[model samples]
Target: MNTKKEKPLHSLFAGATAGAIEAFVTYPTEFVKTRSQFEGKRESPIAIIKDTLKTKGVKGLYSGCTALMAGNSLKAGVRFVSYDHFKGMLADSQGKVSTPRSLLAGLGAGMMEAIFAVTPSETIKTKLIDDAKRPNPQYRGLIHGSVQIVKQEGLKGIYRGLFPVMMRQGANSAVRFTTYVTLKQAIQTRMRTGQNMPTSVTFGIGAVAGLVTVYTTMPLDVIKTRMQSLTARQQYRNSFHCTYRIFTEEGILRFWTGTTPRLVRLMLSGGIVFTVYENIIAVIGARSPDK
Candidate 1:
């Protein structure tokens, strides 16, 4: 058994590679998810997909993919690197991670990604996604949109929902990593075969963890979406104001908007992400002489 811990730098590279792949593969579902979340409108994922296809062709589904891919690369890299580093720091004398430690590590990782990557990337991506659906679109493409936001609203414009983004990502990732680690550990314990857990098992666990994270953090996500989608000048003020308006105007169920598309994207993407991250780490570890 290889006992050497993964280096944070290696985790960062591996995570960025995995994230870039996940973004492209899952961008369509993500577009649908964001569409439904905009303004708390409840639209069927199927209907959104069909309308997007008819209005903009297949490429429409990838409207904000460039921003998403860019953001996800840094977000996922930061998340994995931070989680690995934190987990190593909190590991027991025997180098085993406890449940509480895993959760804490995930919290730290999520906060880091939220602050550095998710806020800006998501803001830009959401604007692009919404623009594609508008009759009079302001921005032409990723570069154009980013430039417009900066020219009009300055750098702060790109970080519209910093608070809710932090909350959503912090809770979402904490639940995801903790649940994934717990489930994976349970599977290993059940097998007790002294053999490596199959890649399929890893994927399965990740999918389940994704489901858990989505439902648990749906409210925060909805609020984050609403806040981020505000105009460059800042319409909603802050996360609290946005959350209050969402509930008072749209009711409690509004917070669950886009649940379907989000679940679909996360389940598949989460499975792919964890499986790829683990496999890459394993390969790297195997090649190292210390391992």
Candidate 2:
């Protein structure tokens, strides 16, 4: 376990930087994934990408990217800072948190981010993406679109799918942090590296954690996306209704509609996020006066 204390501000900065970079680099895959989820029938990532390119050009693949990028940065910053805070409180006298406590901390962090960052941003992103698919797009841009949503629907509009988002995010962080930490510790112990494990190894472990998280939480993700879509109020009454409709109308397989692109993006996201976060933390530590 890493015993060195990390300042919350440092965690925030590193996490935000990591998230922004990851979002920007992996946004095309995310676009494809969301589009696939909206499809009546399952669509391959390649097919979606080709269609998007043909219809909307390369820029089409990046629709709603601004909302997502900003939200991702904020969500990551809050997630890491809150995770560290919770973990610190749960740590033993020796400054180590057990697996269960770490998972709890991650859960707290995920819920915190969901409330403050993820839900609103995700709702906006989903709306923008959905709008862009229309014959006549409604949103002009990020700022304008956001204002329009607020004006038309109020705060509730931008905070659609709060319940599912919270559930998904909480489970997501719990699984991801626990899995990543456990795998990383096991690898480090086997390699006798303590906290000096290679970047490649860290990245590999993080990627595996992402894979685990995706499979476990895919249904929640689909539900969250649907609830946040433009026609959410018209199509579904609540999360439970949305879940039932999807299961009965679409089938259980519908829950995993965008698994391919999500898997790819998250695998890359996990690796990039952890590697960048750790490196930045290391740099910050090295420069600390107390170090």
Cα lDDT listed for each candidate: 0.84, 0.90
Report the error of model 2 at residue 175, Å. 0.6
TM-score of 2: 0.95
Which residue ranges in model 2 land beyond 4 Å of their true spot?
193-195, 286-291
lDDT, residue 230, model 2: 85
Q: In candidate 1, where is summed lDDT lowest over 10 consecutive residues?
A: 282-291
**lDDT tens digits, residues 1-291, model 1?**
112456777788889988999999999989998899887347799999999999899999999899999999999999998887788888888888878778888888999999999999999999898888987788899999999988977998898888888888888888999998788767666774557777888889989999999899999988887777745235576788888887898899888988888898899988989988888877777332112
lDDT of 1 at 109: 91
lDDT of 1 at 66: 96
Least well predicted 10-residue stretch by lDDT in candidate 2 = 282-291
